[model samples]
Target: MSDPHEQTHIDSVGSYVKILLALLVATGVTTAVARLDLGAFNTVVALSIASVKMLLVALFFMHIRHSNKLTKLVVAGGLLWLAILLLLTMTDFATRGILGVPGK
Candidate 1:
């Protein structure tokens, strides 16, 4: 049911160009964000921008957008695992120094 050429060939030259442009834009935004002093919200903005860049890389350059079911499943599983690790790490970080001695 599927065309053979579609599976082996990259999406298109345009797609490659798009990927390049996206990378450049992400990099530019990252640089700009780094220069700004957002205080408590600086990390939040950086993470949000980085997440967008990560999504673009994952979906386009990684070819996950046109991949098979198994590939999609693997990507999903990896993301889920990463989420678990991040959740645990954040929890620990949040708890640390929460009940520590005063003026330690």
Candidate 2:
């Protein structure tokens, strides 16, 4: 017969409370950062916070921490693809000067 102790169980109430507290703190910090007038960097700051929150959600809420290597690889690939997309978009936007493109 299979041993109960060998299998992983879902998190209990205390564990959930801890995760919720962390999320609450992150939300508060993000809110505070939004109040600052960072001008062009505002989007950058907001995205950074969002990415951190995404990590938290993935690791905890999604229970990926206890998942296998293949799942981790899939998550990494998704993040890498998003990074590539952002890079290409930034390159295109920053290089418009070379092509004599009209004002947007």
Candidate 3:
């Protein structure tokens, strides 16, 4: 009988190569997107693309796809923390100009 605790997933070289190609294509797309002027949406678009690339790298290259549920939960928690920090930072930046200083 095989042990349940052992990791059975063995990814192929071809799959890794494909993921690498996809990552390269995503990078090219990011660069292309940066050239155009999209105003406020430019930041949104860039962040969206970056998030996709981050997921791909984490899921495939980092083997998170084959990880157990607990590991996935931990990753989710980390991402949530990052989101909270970014939200706070953006909020602070957005409100900075709302209250004017006496001198300026």
Q: Can you list the residue pairs that collide in candidate 3?
A: none
Task: For candidate 1, write residues 11-96 as lDDT tens digits.
Answer: 88897898889889888988888888989888898898888988888888887888888899998999999999999999998899
Model 1 clashing residue pairs (backbone): none
**lDDT scores in order:** 0.86, 0.84, 0.91
TM-score of each: 0.76, 0.74, 0.81
The runs of at least 3 residues in candidate 2 whose Cα sits more than 4 Å from the true structure, single-residue gaps closed, are 1-6, 39-41, 98-104
Cα lDDT tens digits, model 2, 13-55, are 8887887888788889888989999999989988887788888
lDDT digits (tens) for residues 1-104 of candidate 3: 76777547989999999988988998999899999999998899988988888988999988999988999999999989999999999999989989898998
Error of 2 at 101 (Å): 8.1
Worst 10 residues of 1 by lDDT: 1-10
**Residue 99 accuracy (lDDT) in model 1:** 92
Relative to the unseen true structure, what is the C-alpha lDDT of residue 3 in candidate 3, on a scale of 0 to 100? 75
RMSD list, candidates in order = 3.8, 3.9, 2.8
